[model samples]
Target: MHLNHSPNQNIILEHSSIHLAIKREDLIHPFISGNKFRKLKYNIQQAQSDNAFRLLTFGGAFSNHIAAVAYAGKEHGFKTIGVIRGEEIGFKPELNPTLLFAKSCGMQFKFVTREIYRTKTESNFMDSLKTEFGDFFLIPEGGTNDLAVKGCEEILEESDLIYDYMCCAVGTGGTISGLINASKAHQKILGFPALKGDFLQEDIRKFANQDNWELVTDYNFGGYGKIKPELVTFMNSFKDRHKIPLDPIYTGKMMFGIFDLIEKGFFPKDSKILAIHTGGLQGVSGVNDLLKRKNQPLINL
Candidate 1:
């Protein structure tokens, strides 16, 4: 799981307007399966370099990074701790299967309320967390720092594919920044925010630090972790169409938004674009459980 290989072309929809490289090797493994693997390589090495026994990080209830961090931490002989956002509702934080797997792989949990969790980026919070955890390496949430972006920037190297404009879902701005920075200086990047549109570009700009990145807030599907019937229909049809499973959280919305933009004549007539499928398969089980637990019908399409 920690190894690297050359890209296998999964040419799904190749028209005159687009040359999409849905890499076949990317689709066969666990979702958090590809990009996260690359992102964590440096972090794990950093921990070992520092001779740290534990790796600490932050994420939401359904964070793919937390799962990957745990999996990778265990793999590399480092203990993992997740300072998760939101308070534990029950003793377990309900322990969703995604988190449960992380925990099973030897991840510890430190739950905090949303209010306090917002300040996780503060030096003080990290200082105190370091004091508490005692000599552990702390990875920022979404792994969006210079290192993660530098690592993610290499995703393009595995492919001989190129795009005039690249489309990706912006969650923490790391992947978009990394990919945009990695691509040629002239290439354009369109980022669709998974969360609300408010100040999203401003948020992205903090990571991008350049002019080539554009934020498209049109197709968030009613905000982060929230979905609609049309989205489910689109996901199912897209799965059938491209045979790629897109969860509701990130990649799915970006794909939907890209099509909507194309419909509105946003891009040029023959724009070659690539849509990144950042893996997040662990999210599906929890989202489906969320629907069922709320008695909400999930398959409306």
Candidate 2:
């Protein structure tokens, strides 16, 4: 994977006086882009050091992580296995865009029920997998780990210290954890979780060493993978205005929260805010399919 410095693009907002810029990590790569690219960098190196040529991980029906791991594996000459959640999707994989892409990238699938997937980290489940397949490098769901966090820390450059707030969409908390560690002492790292729960605090604390971060729990738009028509409208309008595409699952929700907070005067006057655009745009096609089926507004790509 080519490690490149993502530029921060200033966003002009007439409604708020806050200085805002978006870290264009989404432009890092077409497939292994954004935080996924960061998260996998060290993990792939560790796998090579350990002499493991196969990479195995977990994700849902439309997981950006799954798509990324597949492409990364193909590009890096490693066999990939995706332990997909939901066994039903395995029977008719063609219907799922994410799974189809992974398959095309030579990623073998081991679809399991949600109940079984819950024990993915357990010794018994892992041993069972090793017996079925050979030894492989294991990446946790959403690719969050110590090595992943180390890669993400590099996302913030020295110039980013000018920003008062560093914001990011939290999935497994890897990206935000890195941001918290890399941020200046006075900078507050705000994480907007895609999932609806307070459990992420613990997950983040496991890796984060700083106390400068807080999770804003009010803008999940119901829950992970759940989106309302208003949120869709906001994302589309944002793209039309800014010419930046945000994935529905993560960045879109975070941007919406930021805009709402701006309207509510959450940030101090003249405060500089930097929002990290963690890439998951590949999943937009799948999301658009769902919206079309529901006869709702589609997120503009």
Candidate 3:
């Protein structure tokens, strides 16, 4: 609820005379946390308003969106169906924590091949899904519709106006768009995109009216769901110092970029920075599994 400051012991902050605090959106809900909660809030309302009996969405192997939607659907009395990207995942749900959690929350899986999944936004594919699943509320992948942006706009409050900079991890561009819309005129919003490319800038501009935002494209490591050993070490040490666990997919990359920028003197002296922790901790198990296979250090969850 409160804008809790992170006690970052990174020496660069002290040298740069910059202040950093984290708005812990992750603490908003146990299951439906952070930006996921914000993104889903209005979408759920819209679905209910339409008298929809079921909610159908899309996601990949270990998508936080899938997990959040499943839990939110079960808790709010809507049947959930996930049109998963990988067909192989259907056979080994138990091995994947995100999928397992979704299944436990009573989400039915319609695992499709990558080729079919690529047509998720096509009319014919959607028509086929409607034919098979019957009438349902459609939530796009990553839950970044206009309504989701509306919900995320509430992530920043008047109390947050004291900060000079507002930063968040960008997935489908919904959360940063909301932050850009809600941010004070004096504050500059920075987005650390979890995935690669300049394409998200266009997606964000579709919802964002303000021009006070820029995406920091350096800290993605490799891309979405990709992590390096150095990142794992930083995340583990950061948790040790701050007692706040960051997921590798989003918040961790954002924080890593924030610290690196601080070291590089990107922020002006005496500037206050507020970084949002958009919770995706559920995906850590899946990431750790990959790390194990690679014989790399796992995230200390």
lDDT of 2 by residue, 1-301 (tens): 8866688999998966799999999998888989999999999999989999999999999999999999999998999999999999889989889999999999999999999999999999999999999899999999999999999999999899899998999999999999999988999999999998889999999999999999999999989999999999999999999999999899999999999999998999999999999989999999899899999988887
Q: Runs in model 3 with CA error above 4 Å?
A: 1-13
What TM-score against the true fold does each predicted structure earn? Answer: 0.88, 0.98, 0.95
- How are the candidates ranked when ordered by lDDT, highest leading? 2, 3, 1
Indicate whether candidate 1 or candidate 2 has the larger lDDT: 2
Total backbone clashes of candidate 2, pairs 3 or more residues apart or in separate chains: 0
Candidate 2 wrong stretches, greater than 4 Å: none
Query: What's the lDDT for candidate 1?
Result: 0.74
Candidate 3 per-residue C-alpha lDDT over 134-153 given as tens digits, one digit per residue, 9 for 90 to 100: 99999999999999999899
Candidate 1: the clashing residue pairs are none
Model 1 reaches what TM-score against the true structure? 0.88
Model 2 scores a TM of: 0.98
**Who is ahead in lDDT, 2 or 3?**
2
lDDT of 1 by residue, 122-208 (tens): 989888888888878878887766677777777675343456777778888878887776777667888888888567666556656
Better candidate number, 1 or 3, judged by lDDT? 3
